[model samples]
Target: MPRAVRPDRSINAEDYQHAPRPVAAMPKDYAPGEEIAPHSHRRAQLLYAVSGVMRITAEEMPAGQAAARPKGIWIVPPQRAVWIPSGCEHEVRMVGPVQMRTLYVEPDAAPGLPAQCRVIEVSGLLRELILALMDEPLDYAPDSRGAAVARLLLQELVAVEALPLHLPQPRDVRLQAVCRQIEARIGEELPLEDIARDAGMSSRTLARLFRRETGIGFQQWRQQARLAEALARLAAGQPVGIVATDLGYAGTAAFTAMFRRSLGTTPSRYFETRAPSPAARGRSR
Candidate 1:
């Protein structure tokens, strides 16, 4: 995969607060598999995808200490944005042809927001606000309509709830080992005992560590990892059967049941509904 191309010096988060403009937006189109190398911003960011999925991995910290931050993965679909605190190192990969619209907020302007990286809902008002703000120059007059829009956008960001969809990274060497195995062969069948043994820990010991580190049992953590992986494969147009079999389900039927249980939608409808369907796009073409 190639990296994204951007002109001008990269800006940091704090600069947004002192600039003539307190908010900024940069719109771009990305091909599938395109990535941005690990980097950090001086300004906080709201990464909103107008039409595709973005796989974001930021440093995550343990449980309630997400505010402390270590690393986590956010599978951002349309109508959603990932809020990243200023100065957090992260990377992004486009899962499909992504029409991305990102908002960079001044931390001083939007205080009390999540300190860690996580997904936030993009409401209709917020969506239009982003479009409107994108048109203003970085130094727009503070008293102008653009300024009002910027302030309101900050307010809306504060009220939204964080989605419980991000995959938190485990820090312990033993816990990390099990997570790597689950992702390496997401669909392959492997007993927990076997996975624990590979990590040089008994099954019970590993399970305890998972709960302590990630705040979830081993099974739940693995399922979310599989879901995150499934989103990537499905967004890239993998077949339902292939994904199901790859994830370790018995068949398409069983795989879908777990998918629906985990994500609340069937695999066939998940990515398609996030954007226009092929048939719908065909008619437009």
Candidate 2:
């Protein structure tokens, strides 16, 4: 398979933020498998999934050494943006066709944004303002109303909170195979050794790779994966027992224990406590 080609995109941050040019718009029908490469910017970025879903991978670098392999950010529609702090190295992939909007904000305006990756709500007014800015002609006057609206858009962005959904990936083929197995048989319970064998590695090797890639051992990732799957089923009104059994747990009690350990809430309580899903933002919640 051909790897996605990262686009070589550049815009002068000073000119972009202060020149009063209208905001650039993203295409309505966007396809996945496009790469944005390993790049950094002085300006912070707000990546919004206007429709469909996207996956984001981020790496932390210190002193210019390449860090660990990137993990996952599963972004869907309704929630508008993923706030990336300045100087962070990240990559993006589309799960489906997505219509995404990206707002590059001034570095000074970034302090109020999320310190880490998160999902933020996009209100109707804010969304419209962003769209309108995109519609504005380039070379717009600095004193134009569009510039004022741009300022307001920045303010509204600060008020949005980042909701997190991180899924870790492994570099080792053994660990990668283990993860693939779990995803394939999500509805079945498989022994650890069996999973290791499928991955063509010993259980010990698999465990070590799991720690290296995901920062968690095999069992923990599995439990979290189970809980993640359960959350989706429950949101779809699946019965608790059915969800539990489907995930290969002994019963609802077993599933609840794992869910609480990972998410700090029981299955029943989590759904109740979480704010309602954004409009059309339904997934295995």
Candidate 3:
């Protein structure tokens, strides 16, 4: 069997952003902690990591309107991808050694593609399609094998389920400050009253504001923040016990319960089940 093509780390995705092809695949590897600075593209993007995890911050802008405020944060692990609409500014930080497979799709190529930024579950078929397209040239013939794969990939994108991996940011300055504190002290058990008082608002007002702005209660938002940090640390190879303790859980059992409730699996089992087979990894090389 032929060896899979190695990704050229030096290649820039921007160079092929305007290629004649409706879809272009870019494979890049990043070291742990490496970050892609804020930038936007003319084409929409599906950002997937075959291994490791990524935390992405993005802001969307409708056509002919000024850019909106930073919208939300998405924590994308293996088996999931974040869809970024055309002209949305975003930045990505790798939580571990990352093998990123991204598709840049022309906005008009697929009808009904999401207009807002979201995290979607990547099916195994879609993953394979993306990997196959990476083996083809960016400007392959319209009727070629690559084009067929790209068409199927776009179809899959429209059908994939969106995940609840988003952490929406609030526009209110007071809520933003409270959220920042919660994130900064993710491991601590922060009381709502204390946080509200610190932000110069009463507890009732704070709770209402949280629900109004983020669509979740204060504790729920805090747990989601903890979940994001826990995922990043776990992806970086931290032990379950350490992650649990660091996140202020009473014990591994408590942390595991929370993690399972939020993600449908324990920490150990979550990464274990999502890990690609050796053959699959080899094919995606």
Give the best candidate by lDDT.
3
lDDT of model 3, residue 102: 85
lDDT of each residue in 1-285, candidate 2, tens digit only: 322111222233344444334343322335555555656655566776656455566653321344553544434333355777666667776655555656666556534655555656566677666655554544546788767777778778778754434556777766767777897788777888888887787988878878977787787777656755665466546789999898898988988887777656786765452222232222211
Candidate 3 residue lDDT tens string, 87-117 = 8888999887788888899989988998888
Best by TM-score: 3
Alpha-carbon deviation at 267 in model 3, angstroms? 2.1
The window of 10 residues in a row where model 2 has the poorest summed lDDT is 2-11
**lDDT measured at residue 19 in model 1 versus the true structure, 0 to 100:** 59
Q: Please give the distance, in angstroms, between residue 24's alpha carbon in candidate 1 and its true position after superposition.
A: 1.3
- All candidates' TM-scores? 0.80, 0.57, 0.90
253: Cα error in model 3, Å: 2.3
How many residue pairs in model 1 have overlapping backbones? Answer: 13
lDDT of each: 0.73, 0.60, 0.82
How many steric clashes does model 3 contain? 0
Clashing pairs in 3: none
